[model samples]
Every structure is written in structure tokens, then in C-alpha cells.
Target: MPIPSRPRAAALAVSAALLSTSLAACGGDSKDDVDLPSQTLSWKDCPAPSESEGGGEPPSPLPGGTEWQCATMKAPLDWDDPKGDTIDIALIRAEASGAEDKRIGSLIFNFGGPGGSGVTTLPAFGTDYAKLRTRYDLVSFDPRGVGRSAGVECEDAEQLDKYFQQDSTPDDEAERQKLVDNVSAFNGNCEKHSGKVLPHVRTTDAARDMDLMRQVLGDDKLHYFGISYGTELGGVYAHLFPKKVGRAVFDGVVDPTEDPEQGSLGQAKGFQLALDNYAKDCTSQVEDCPVGDTPQDVKDKIAKLLRDLDEKPIPGIFPRDLTQTAATNGIAQSLYSKDFWEYLTEGLQQAYDGDGKVLMMLSDSMNGRNEDGQYSNIQAANVAINCADDKPRYTPQDVEEKLPEFRAASPLFGDYLAWGMLGCTDWAVGGAADHPDVSATGSAPILVVGNTGDPATPYEGARKMAQALGSGVGVELTYKGQGHGAYDSGNKCVSEAVNRYLLEGTVPKEGTVCS
Candidate 1:
């Protein structure tokens, strides 16, 4: 929805809180009535993440010397034609450490992005979920159209570098046209490179793949841990296979009720809220808030800086300058977690002095471009999946009509987010729906966790998700903390609540609040 910023591309890394899990190593078939090929999984020692998965070293072994294993499951390329050509759904797992007799089945995770490589992410954050691993094999996977899973490829790094540099919030007709042309060109690149895969990368297709994955993994029911966009995916899965949902947890829940336009607008307000909170938190500290004299002063200064960057770019990351768009993205990336607030502060201070390296790095991280200038397929897949799932293709007039409302939501972020509507304007594939359908009348209870200070997937989304998931299917948990997802917050109540539900099948009381 929101052209893949925190609205969310789940703004990857999920900030330090989500990724702060113990670093380690990190599938599916068609929708309904999948007749998966009967085959035993041949798991092997995991290899280093592929270039599309954000090139990195192989995951280190877990704390107790349990190594991560990787496998690939074949799923139908198109669920509508279940017996059609297959696509490999990359999977990774760490077997349960507890006694075999006591071990539950697999506990799968999807960390949003619609694009993030679970093949890489699960290992990096393995230890954080060790408790869950005590009884269940911790599992995650690269959904179809993601890394190592027939990944979608678009523009190369050099093209993307220039793509990100262009002004996103167009001010005039010519600038608007240029922005549209750039978006069209980028979308064109995706179609030219991965057209065959684009049409089948919808969330429904991935949901179907998960059902097939359940069969291949020998899990009677899908025990999922979904975060950010992962939450949306989980909801869609529940909708498709209600009885198959078992002990699921959705944190950083996406609002399934809103269309792309509404969702993007919601993000503008959410990011603004996070920014305001950051300002207040900083200025109230014992030492001076280096960025400003007061909370409002802090915001004013940031607004001014963005305006300044728009007029004149600052030196950043050697040859790459930090433009207004880059700084905004960087700031948005930092606000994904309270731990990253320090980086935001430092980035702002550095930018103030004409040193834009830090901000550019943050922006680079958001765009899935590493220091080596190699770009991951996350951006490409993000657009592919989102354009395939979302039904609306907003025009400039639609954005212009909504400009006042978006501006009223957040002065610092409104225009940038509003302009993002054009991202899928020229997408080759037709979208599935205006918004996802998450209604699951006979589904198992899904614990939906929402953070009060979430900058993406705002707090209201949790209530909406719960209500939409239908009575008895979605239980709401409120965490009075700052970050993208609640489980990773290390909040005693949130962790206990989630753990108890997933492990013991003990549902927390509805509307339960945790700090």
C-alpha cells in the first residue's frame, strides 16, 4: 500500500527490536484442495543468503549448537491451475531442541515485506524465538516471488540509485510527469524481467503456497507468527483455510479493511505520531535533545531540514547526495524502533552539518541496497506483490484530491506518501482486490498484537483487524510500547501472552493490555 515505505515494505530490519532476535540461519503450494506431491523434505545445512535475499554470511548456529537447515518445496506457479508448472518456495528451519516426544509441530514465521527473505531473516533472529523452539521447530520461508523462490527482478542497482534520487513529492506538473515516468519505467523493468512471475505473486497465491507448505512440512495445521505485512498475509491465509489456522499470532497488524489509498493515508498519520513521540521522548531526557530545544522545536527543525534538502541536497555516502526523499525515508526507517532513535538523532545532527552519510545508509537499508551498491529483489518483489494484490491504481488526480487530507495528517510526511500513490500506476499485472478479506468465522483464535507507538500499521488497525477477523477468531492484545511488533519488544506481558497462547493454547482475555 503506500509505495513500500514503512506503510510497510514492513520497512525491513523491522528495526532493531524485531531483528534483535538471536542471529542464526533461516514454502508452499496452491490454495484450496492442494494435492501436494508426497515427498520427504531433504533439509541441508543452510548456505549464505543469496544476493536477492540481501547478500550476507550464512546464519550462525543457535545457542545450544542446533544448526539451521534449508529446503525448497515446489508449489504451483499459479494456484488457479494447481497442476501447472511449479515454483520453488524456499524454506529454512531449526528443529525443536526439547525432547522429541514433547515437541509440537513447526511454528512458521513471516516477517512482512511481502518481499523480505525469511530464508535470511529467520536465522539472523533465531535465538529471540528460542522459547518457541523449545516445543516447535521454528520455521520461516521466502514466499513465492521473494528471494531464492523465483524472485522478481527489476531495475539494476545503478538504475535504482538514480530512481531513489529523483524527487518523490512532485511540486509542479513537469515534476509530477517525471515522477510518473520514473515509476512507469521501474514497473516496466519488473515486467520485462519477471513478467511471468508477476501475475501469480498475489498474497492469495502465497497463502495457497503456505497450505501446500503445511502438507510438505507434515504440519496438521499452520502455526504462524506474522509481523507487519506478515500479519496481512496471515489474515488472508486464515480467510482461505479457516480450520487450518492453529495458534497464530499477528503482531504489527495491517488493517485489512482499508484499501490502498486509505492504508497509505493512515501511514502518513502513523509516521507523524511516531515522529511526535520521538521528539517528546528526546526533549524530555536529562541531557539536551541535540536536535532541538523543545518537542515542537524538534519537529520544526526536521521540517525545515527536509525543505532545505529539497532546495539543496547534502553530501551523503560519498558520491550519493541525501535529497529530501532519502532523508525522509531514513528518518522513517529509524522510527521503526525506539532503539533506532539514536541513529535518527545522529543522522539529523549530521545532516545539519552537511554530513549525510548516516542518513543515506539508513535510506539505503530501507531500499534494500547494501553498501556495495547491490540491490536486493525486495523492492522489486514489494512492488510486484503489492501491485498484484491491491486493486486500485491511483492517478495523480486522486492523489491531488486527497492532498489536503494527507497534509492534515502529517506535514513532514504527507506529500511524500501521497505521491507514492503513483507507484503501481503502470503495473503490468491486474490487482486482486481493493483490500484483503480476513473474515474467518470458523477459524482458530489468532492473537493480534498492536503497539501504541507503531509508526506503520497504526494502533487502530489492531481493533479493526480483530473485528474483521470475525468474533472468536481474532483476540486483540495491546502493548503500550514503541516499535513495529510487540513480541520482539521483550515486554514481559506481551511475550508471556503470546507464548502462553502459542505454546499452551491459553487465549488471553480480549482487549488485554500489556506494557
Candidate 2:
């Protein structure tokens, strides 16, 4: 199944009070008088595995042709003091099967979730990444506060259910206040329940851990492939240790310098762009399409439908029903991938018919719900990382500041998602780190790919991120295609270019466009 591309939930605009401190220090060290523990790790002598992993036992082999193994290391919670409390970093390695002595260094892979679990996903889907796996020892790990690696867990299933039950878009002051209170309570709960792991969950710490993994594998240079927020993490790594970068690829890049509010407003516009594409695709199939001739009319119809549903939810069959939030989420998610247009049209038709089951399913997927009606840990991690990364600078007065742009860009979703910054105002965690610029002046050339119609990460972000990196350049792969990440979804031109870059260390020219 295609992964849904929702907006980064917690990237609020930073406050002036939070930007006074510098963010240039690397290895997690701060310039303050009180030094924090140095967040570094070194590998010790250990027996090499009889062979790389694949085909077998209790630990289970990775599914692809590559071989796999496990490694663990210790990193300090704070990065200045070498003696501070330590956290364990869990990693999995998948080695190339060519001539044993000719193996290139390890290639690290991360699929963007400030919470996405690479360790879990790599084993099964590692095959799709065969080009890189065949040349380097492919490595994946659970960054701190994620999956198997001492991940932070939150509210019980029921409370979490209640949390999702609350509306993300508030129609009035009472509803807005409720959202603020719920987000604050959620943040408080994370601090109370995961304090031991909270402070260590920063992206800088995760980058440090990646460096340690590079050492454990005995690689002097690092080759990395990071997607989505993974691009953000990769950017941070490149900034801190530019010289250590190997063949790095960042697809669906996020521009680090963008203020959250401005960035999200841009994202709202990007989504609308993708939605317009979806509408065109939908019209091609006259039977299932529900949109009107012009994009404006289609958008207006959607707005009226949402308002109508909000006042009186559209009921489904025996076991399902659609709340305003679910319907909205479904429409939003479908806009991310043109491949989803058919399904989205069906969903819209059902919503129009007062049976919201299909739309509800899309919403469930957007929120990561399982068949058993359980939610994944993704939502918590999404909120935590984003909140910790930036602070909300919007005030009641500021609401009017960008309202016109937002409304014009996203008719149905503008006000609701643009105002999502309010959730961070009540966060107990306070502000974010000062620096947002992540460049790799000393690292090898990294490949950054962008799709023109990406809803989550705008194409312009790809251009901006490429500009930020000292040695990197952005490749505007014109995906006459639509989707969040376009790497493995079959555009031979794109896959071949990326594969050649990863397997042979060939950086395509600056303005390389793959259609």
C-alpha cells in the first residue's frame, strides 16, 4: 500500500525568544558553562558474523537477497559531557553479496518518520532497494524514541483513542480551546511517561547515533538515503559532519530554513496543486468522477459537503460512520497521490450519498489505524518531534497575518490546518533549537529529488534544500507523476538515475530532469 502524506503536524513558527542561542555546535555539544554529556559512541572488538544475514533463525533473516546482522552502541543523552547517562542505539545491517573484500562502505537508509521505523521496514522491503544493497552493506535502525530501540510509548490505547476522537479543526472558541487543552495534556503525558527518553529524542542526537553506527560498521565515510523527514535528518548529519558524507540521496526534501507557519501555508498550496491534478485525472474517468468542470467549483462543492457533514455526520453501513475529521483527512490524504484519485472519487461519491465508509477507511489509514481498531505510535511521535523542533509564534493578531494566503491556497483546509500551530502554544516542552540551516560543505555530493506535484513536501522545498547544502544539488525529476515519494513507484528514468547514483557513486548533473 502507498503510504499517506499528511502535513508535518508540529512544525510551528519559532519565537524570537527561542532563536537567541546558536545551533551550530555539532556532536550535541552546547556552548553553555554547564556542559552536557558528550553524545558519542565507539565500537569495541567483536567477532564478525559467520556470514551476512538472509534465510534463517530466531532473529529472522532480512527478506531481500542481502545479508543482515544486528549491532548496539551507547550514546549520551546530552552531547557535551562524556560521563552523562547513556541511551542504547539498535541497528540492523544488510551486507552486499559480491566479492567479500570489495564491499563498499555501509549505506544507511531512513524512510522519514521523525518516527518511521527503518529497522522494521528494511527486512521485508529491502529487496526493492537491491541496487544499493548489492553494492554496500545496507543499514537501518530505530532512531531514539521509535520502535525496537528503547522507543517512547504514550497514553494507553483508550486515551489515545479519545485523543484521536477529538477534532483537529475547531469551528469555535470552545472547540479551539479543547484542542489546545488536549494537545497540552498530550505533551504533558509524553513528558510524564517518557521523560527518560524525551530529552534524547532530538534530531541532533539521532544524527550522532548515526555517526556511531558508521563507526561500528568500520566505515570512515557515510553513504545515506533519507526520505521525507528523513531528508531533514540527513541534512542535519551533513551539516554536523560534512566530511563524513558519502553518496547521500534525499528525496521529497523539506526546506530547513522555512518558518513552520509559512512552510505549512506553502504546503497547503502544494496540496491544492496536487488536488487539482487529481481532479484532472478523475475527470478522465467520467463514470466515477465527482468534481465539477473548474477546480474552483469542485473546491466549493467540497467545502459545502464538509460543512454539511460537520453539522450532521454522514452515516455508513452497520459498523461504520464518517465524522467531519475522517472525511477531511481522507480527502487530504488522497490528494497526496494521483494513484489514489479513483479511490478518492469513490469516497467522495459515497460521502455525497451519505455513506461515509470508504472515506472513513482512508482517514483510518491516514491516522495509521489497524484492523482491530488500534492506533499506531506514529501520531505521538509525529507530534513530539515536530513540537520539539519548532515553537509557535502565532497570536490571535497573527491569525489575520496569513489568513488570506492560506484561504486562497487551500479552500477546505486552510484555516483549520494553518491554525494548527495553536497546539504548540500550550506544549510544556517550550521552544526548539535555533538553527534550521543544515548544509554539507565538506561532504560528498548528495542527490536531492523532488516531484512537481508532491503535496507534503513542495517542489520548491527541494530547490531550497539543494541550495542550502554546500556540495549538494537538487535534481528536479519532473514526475509528470504525483505522489509524496517517487523513488520506487516505477518511473524507470528516476529509478535508473537513482540506482546508478547509489551503486556507482555517480552524481547526476545539477539540473538533471528525469521525466
Candidate 3:
């Protein structure tokens, strides 16, 4: 699944991992031996906002009023040239609530953005992780090219607003060229503003930074919790340091085997399945069903609405009108979680009534566009990392060639997603398309969780990830539910199983399904 920093917007999902055969052995190799500094962290009060100020968001689950410690560490900007330039990585640590004797080592967290800010995500969701905080230090860091690190900055909010407002589903060649021109402008801005760091803001580089974190924290082995794109990081880390892997959990797994094109197609099919599920659920409702009773009817209605919006945009609260790209992103974001289905229903109803405010709100939330019209660096970092990790660059013609397969995979979302790949066609840095075979050979049992109806990362990819990790090493835990990431959302079975594994080193039996 393409794990966007925000709820997932603009049809872009970021993922990349290590290819086992391509990378050399971990230790003793010149490339592997970076003399990182060993420094003690001077703990200070974490800057977590109060519950009231946080809009009733629960305080961090850490004991003593949800306080945490923050610090920064230095790492080589380019792992290949360890002695070269350096960059700072931000970190947050909530000490174990339990007695010191009962505490386990640090449990690092990655919330899958190739661009998502761990600094923010951890504080917001740290309460759900209360079960683990008792026995382990809950820690997370913004990956390079992400928040608080050396972030990738592109256009300001005004420019980005115009960018998001552009038509993504082109009809004629002239319209297609407009799409290309917009992407080119965005890419050029990235190169102009952050080109120096863009090449190094890769998954492999982030994984290396993770190892540095482990070392500086004085942990002999690393214990990690990775979701979505973070799973790709964990997979790469396992391949890079199998011996250092300890009790890693990869939820909403990304298949390390697929190339960029294959990955995009797979995600297209996955999102289509999720849309189908939503349609079924919506049609069953006794009231407030915007679309007709049948799935095909619902699909046709939504498709026609999108087509209509493409022709005649709907004016909204914002200065700009609701374009097809924004509308599509708004619809796709709702598929990430079932909780948003009702809101989606409301938004679609409003759209039918010729009001675009609700859908525009959903679109803005998915894009990380705040009330002030400013955007988080999520989109910029997402593009940078995905393009840097995957080498495949498709031209407009190449995308046209693959349009049939993509459309067949997801008639509603395929065309936009297919065109999303073109953003990397003129990428400043060349990425390695083939991810290393991630057997995670010789590592401890790794937990892989999959949401059967997950729209972003499909259920089958999780099964494949487990199989690829080899015998006795990777175990799959199925959450037979909808949404992107499963643990602690609502499934007690999943939460407890993951808790047991992280706390007691207990691996769930194979084929364990949690509802």
C-alpha cells in the first residue's frame, strides 16, 4: 500500500525496502562501518500539549501526566560517505511506567510516512500504545526528509492549493500536458529548494539512521513497531541486520517483492476492493444511502459525479473550487477507515446537492492542509522517498500503455493512480526499483499483521510478506476488519496479541485470525 504521511492523499503511496542480494554484509564492510558518536541524551520535558489544548485528545499514556523527553542526534547525511555532511534526527522517548527492573529496552515506532512525523503521530496515538509503555520506552523519530529532521520543502500553501486544485484525470492530450506541467513544476520546486537532501532522503538512508538510533540508545538489538511504509523500513532493517532484529512488528505490511509498477497496480486493486466493501455497506443502510442499491449502480453514480465535477467544478469555502483531483482524494481517504464512512456519505450527499465544503474538508485533511492553508511536508517527503527508492520512471505514453490494466484493477481510482507514477519520471535522483528479497534470514520471529479489508496495503501482501520472510522467522496475524492499520483501533484480540508479543516475547501461532 502507498503509505502517505497524511491519511493518504493525491493517489500517492510511498514504499521502499532493502534488496538482500544487492546490499553487502552488515559488519566489517567499509560501507557498513560508520563511526557514529556515542553521546548521552540530556532528558528534558516533552512538549506534549494538554488534553484541553489538544482538543480533548487524550494525554500521552505515560505515567505522571503524560510527560515525555525529547532529544536530537546527529547522523551522516549520506551513509555511503560517512565522513561527509551531517544532519540532525529528532527523537521522543516516554520512559517505561513500570519498575526499572521490569523494563525492556526501547521500542522504536515508525508510522509509515515515508513523510509522516513520528514526533506528532506518537503524541496523538501514544495512548493506544499505553499497553506497551509500561514495559518499554516508547520512542519514535521523524525519518530524514520528514518533520523536524532535514525536511523537504517545496511550494508554499498558496502554490500547493493551486496544485491540488488542478485536474488529475485528463481527457484530451492538452489536458494531459497540463497534468504533466503541474507535476514538473512541483518537481522543479523540490529540486530548487531541497535538492541537496532529496537524494539522501531514501528508505535505506532512513533505515541506517534507525540503526544509529539503536546504537546511541545503547541497545544491542533493536525492537521496532512499523506500520505501512514503516514495514518496508523494518523489512530493510531486518535484511541489513538480521542479528540485530528483536521482536519487530510489521503491521499493514508492504510486499518487498513488488517493483514500482507492480506495487501501484496491487494498491489500485486493493483500493477498489475497499470501495466495493464501502458500497455494499452503504447500500445495506436503511436511510441516507446516496447511491442506489446495487454496487455497480453506486460505482456508476460516483464515477459520473467525478466526471461531472471534472467538467464543471463546484465552488467551496476555500478560494478554489473542488476539482476532480481533490474530490478523488477526498473519496479515497474515507476508504482508509470505516469510521469516516458516515462522513463520506454526508460529503457525497452534499456534493450531489451542489455544495463542496464537506468533500473539500475531507480532501484538505487527507492532504495535511491545515486551517491556515499551510501544508505539512508530508506530500513533498512522500514523493522524494518513493521516487528515491523505486527506480521506475514512466512517461505519459508509458502510463497510457498501462491504463487498461489499472482501470480494470480499479475503474474508479485507476486512472489517477496510474498518472501518479509520472511524478517520478523526471526525478532528480535515480532510485533502485527492485527491493531486495526480504527473508530477514536468521532473525527472531517477526510479527506481520494484515487487515483483510485494508484498502491501502491489501491483505494478500501481508501473507506474501510473511512467506517471504522465510520459515519460523515471520508470522502473520490477520485482523478480519476494514481500515489501514489494525492494532488498538478496536480489536481487543489484535491489541492483546501484539501486547503479549511485545511484552512477553510471545509470538502468536501461525494463521491466527483476530476479528
lDDT of each: 0.85, 0.65, 0.77
- Better by lDDT, candidate 3 or 1: 1
lDDT for model 1, on a 0 to 1 scale?
Answer: 0.85
Over the stretch 309-408, how does candidate 1's per-residue lDDT look in tens digits? 9999999987889999999988888888887899899889999999998788888878888767888888889889999999998899999999999999
Which tens-of-lDDT digit does each residue in 1-515 have in candidate 2? 11223322211000011111111112322222232322333322212211111011223455543346666666666655546777776677666856767678788987765666565446546666766666787778767776555666667656865665567666678876777788778778878887776655677768777776665566777788887788888888888777778788888778777877767777778777877777676665656456565566666777888888778877742355576666777777666555567667777877887888776766655655544555555556666666667655555346556777888988777775666655455554644654365866656787888887788888887878888886444444444467776675568878888888888877777777766
Give per-residue CA lDDT, model 3, range 276-328, as digits (tens).
Answer: 99989998887746755677788888898899999898986557788778889
Query: What is the lDDT, from 0 to 100, of the residue 512 in candidate 2?
Result: 74
User: RMSD in Å for candidate 1, one decimal?
Assistant: 3.8
Predicted structure with the largest lDDT when compared to the true one: 1
lDDT (C-alpha) at residue 388 in model 1: 98
In Å, residue 122's CA in model 1 sits off its true spot by 0.8
Q: Quote each prediction's TM-score.
A: 0.95, 0.84, 0.91
Which segments of model 2 are wrong by more than 4 Å?
1-71, 286-297, 316-320, 393-397, 471-480
Comparison by lDDT, 1 against 2, better one: 1
| TM-score ranking from best candidate downward | 1, 3, 2
* lDDT at position 235, candidate 1: 95
